[model samples]
Target chain A: MNIKNSNIIVLVSSILLVVGFIISIVNTMVLVSPTEHIEGSWKEISWEYEKTESGNTNKKISDAIKTEICKELIIHEAEVWNFLAGGNLELTSNTNNETLSWTMKGRGNILELSHKTNKIEHYNIQILNNDKMVLYFSTDIQAKGIVKMTFEKIKEDSYAQKI
Target chain B: MLRKFSNSRTLKDNIQLGALSAFSAGMVNVTSLIIFFAFTSNVTGHYAILAEEISKGNWYQASVVFAWIFMFFIGNFISNIIIINFNHKNAYAAHSAPLIIEIICLLAVGYYGHFYYRETLSETEIMVGTMLFAMGIQNGLTASISNFSVKTTHLTGLTTDVGILTAMFTKKKYRQNKQLRSKFNVLLAIAAAYLAGGIVAGVIYYEAKFLVFFAVSAVIGFIILYEYYKLKVTKYIRIKRTIKLRKGILETT
Candidate 1:
């Protein structure tokens, strides 16, 4: 109602606005949608048995079994998974390159990958963020347990871009 | 189906409403699953996702899921409010309003996805949100009208009920109970219809894509129109009987 009161109100409101904007930016830096978090070149770090039923402590899975596990899977041991915009996924390894499509289901909890041949594979997204994405998939391989796949986000797509 | 109130609804009415609505729900769920990669008819998984997002500190996604959940809640609230407030005035109007809104929502999603869809995050989010709202309206209306006997949105409780009914039928007394048998028949019809709808939609989605929503809308439209036709026929029969009785009284006088 008074001039001084109005001026003080404006000053406080402007300060609040600035503070809110700063917090939003900071939060955005830390937060990302599943799509945004997944849209990059991710190199496969390791493949390990998530759990064993026979109490076998051999959690370490060799890369050889990867082919058997991925037998029905079109992504067979693809070392690098590059998720691009518009549902395009470029999978590559040391030997050859493959292309597929990807979509996130159930609030980004499920990563569904579809090959051009109409073969579909779903991977449960255990933990996904800026730097790391952990995935789990059921395997009927020799060790009948969940297979945990860990992947690290490639900051630069230079290596992936080559293929 | 739309004309009857809760206690007055017969077993036939309940089964008809349950089967058809469940079929449409299944179709919508599968279609949304294929297109948006989200389940629209069911909110249970969405609840889990909301919790996960909140726990993970992804405030944006948490808020998105929160909004989606809220849309569903608000849809149910609005459907129930319409029914409770207007049923005393006009049961048919009260029941039909939510379904009309549902049809509009589905059509909007279909139109947008068919024509203007860019498949962006925001677009997918909004489409899925609208679908969830549509499903909520449908679930609310069926449940409200049927006195909560015919909930067709999700199969979790329905499956549990079917399981319980099957277990009960193992006993001779429960097996002979007419009400239990009719309820079992209704539940089984709904489950079968839902699965059939899902399989049909899944089979057709690859070909029809967004156009399948038009088929869903048609199914809901058929329910509304069929009820209207039945209401008209019943009204006509009652009017004819009343006129004949008046004529007989006049002749006697």
Candidate 2:
């Protein structure tokens, strides 16, 4: 390896690194806009809470408690959230429906859902794509930890049929 | 240690490089696991996940895993490319360049995690990928410069080597082999250091959080600076010896 070759290699590595950094930033900007991808109806696919116990151990909550929590959150089986264009979010399940206002902040990563009583809930958007959205939030209630909720976009035809 | 290739590296050099890099690798691996729910140092589990995701037809997850693997691969590739191209002109510089990059990556992760990280999946994924690349660079440089004798990121191979050597030691002839003993020592040092690093990081993470990365970077920086200091000392001694010899000749003449 000569000096010239070494210089070239260093230059190339630096360029590649800069390019990679740029691409990563650009990809985040272009591929992850919550407002655009988050609109429309979404069905809850799964929800999980990871609790940190002693020794930094992580344990998932029991099924019964998980079910209760899900029920409390109005996210029972086949629960859906219809995110309308004008900041309206409609949460519906088999037996219940509720409407909430939603706004995104922090580069479309922080989702703030507001109720009529002026209560606001914030969820960090883990992932938001055309077909799926994963949101995460922390809770200090029973089995305190972070909760991750995954949702799949409900296709227009299926949503129409359900309506 | 800085300029010597693997065939020429002493047992001391091998142990020093292996242990320090392994320690940092362990810290990065454990810290990323604790914070991001991902492992950044090694790709074996990621490969398995990739396979599983592919089998399950989860393209998104499979692709993410694939990208992680690729980032690790590129880290190795870039490090080796730097080394092979520049080992002749300035072996130390060639070797240190990758560590510099690794340090930068770890620092970025640490700073962002401490101040700006929102604990989002995107943030986690990007940070993990950055760490994987950093680890790859480290693994590549150590292995390449040491003539493939040192791999600090993962212990599966080292553990296997140790197992084989231990089994061989059951024979008297193998016990008499100095090379085998040296290899065993290097492996043991790396394994112990890796475990120690992980334990330290785990304990410190409770208090320092992402600032643990700064500690890891300092460890790596010590490795590079120590070598540079050694190089300078060696050069200074050589200059002093040459001057003494010249003075002696002048007096005699």
Candidate 3:
């Protein structure tokens, strides 16, 4: 090998490596920024239902204490959601809001919020909710993989106001 | 006349043949990648991609990938049959058959791709399959001549070999020094040239896709003519000198 020629190859190789690394970094940063920096929190509710196998009665039935259970479930859910919201919610001032929809792919997320005739799009919102308080959140995932999530709704706070 | 026909001729013949084959491989790789978004030169990367796609349940993309693979196999099969029947060891005649096949395929691409079947089949499928076959034939025919040492199709193995050889050169334990250096240099040249060719191919294909194949055909033609001329001239000069010496001997006698 000619030392000079080999040196040139080495130089080219280093340049290619650096360029590749930089591209990878930029791509990652661009992809991660919106998803990581979304300025919203999810207010959600959780309900747990179970099946029981009994010898005498192998049928579905809501427990006799179902109302209390439901109330506790709702209250627990509200507290958790309120804790998650960190005081960033309005309960008294009701205003018409539109439902937003979005999809997350690879490193990036695309969000679409539709209200009236005008729809606004957000980048990288981890969670969203409609007026009915249904929560929609996204997580970073592979080309295709199981994305883990938790959803719930919080109790109303009288003093809370929308920012 | 007889003395001129010796083993050294074999070395020169193989080098010229190998370089041409390598160039053909490069052209095939470039053209295939540009047209099909697939690589026919080496199936290793393709296989990896296929596996990943399959795992992700990407059946459509996997099918497209396999189309290229099948085309490459077709190219290899066709080239092998042609070479086996005609005895492609002869320099000029050996390259001509494959060159004709490659040109015919390109014309087919222009015809089928442009007007006749453009709407019939997906562009991606046609381009991938056809380019695969082109690279296959190009690789198969030239690979036959080069004893497969010089591959133009891809540089992964070449890069690996170069790395190994370079590392070996640094170690002080090698017994065969001079021979090692020559072999290493040859590997280095093959790899470096392959990368350079890839970069050039990328640039050229952006401007003119068909020119890539035409340029390759020209290069291979040039190599064949070069070897033919060099061998004929050397033989002719040797014969003339031999005749002159015989005449001188007769005069002296």
Q: For model 2 chain A, give the 10-residue run with minimal summed lDDT.
A: A50-59
Question: What DockQ does each candidate score versus the true complex, computed on alpha carbons?
Answer: 0.18, 0.08, 0.02
Better candidate by lDDT, 2 or 3: 2
Q: Candidate 3 lDDT, tens digit per residue, B37-148?
A: 4465687887786687568644444555555565676687788677667653554464556657766666566455445532211444565566667767776765565555
In TM-score terms, candidate 2 sits at 0.68
Docking class of 1: incorrect
Pull out the clashing pairs in model 2. Answer: B6-B146
Please list the C-alpha lDDT of all candidates, in the order they appear: 0.85, 0.82, 0.50
Task: Tell me the deviation in Å of residue B164 in model 3.
Answer: 1.7
Instruction: Tell me, by TM-score, which candidate is best.
Output: 1
lDDT string, candidate 2, A42-137, tens digits: 988876774433323545555576666666453334378999988888888777788888776533446777778776677877677779899888
lDDT for B30 in candidate 2 is 90
TM-scores of the models, in the order given: 0.80, 0.68, 0.51
Q: Against the hidden true structure, what lDDT does model 1 obtain?
A: 0.85
Estimate how well candidate 1 is docked, as a DockQ score. 0.18
Model 1 chain B is weakest, by summed lDDT over 10 consecutive residues, at: B60-69
In terms of DockQ, the best-performing candidate is 1
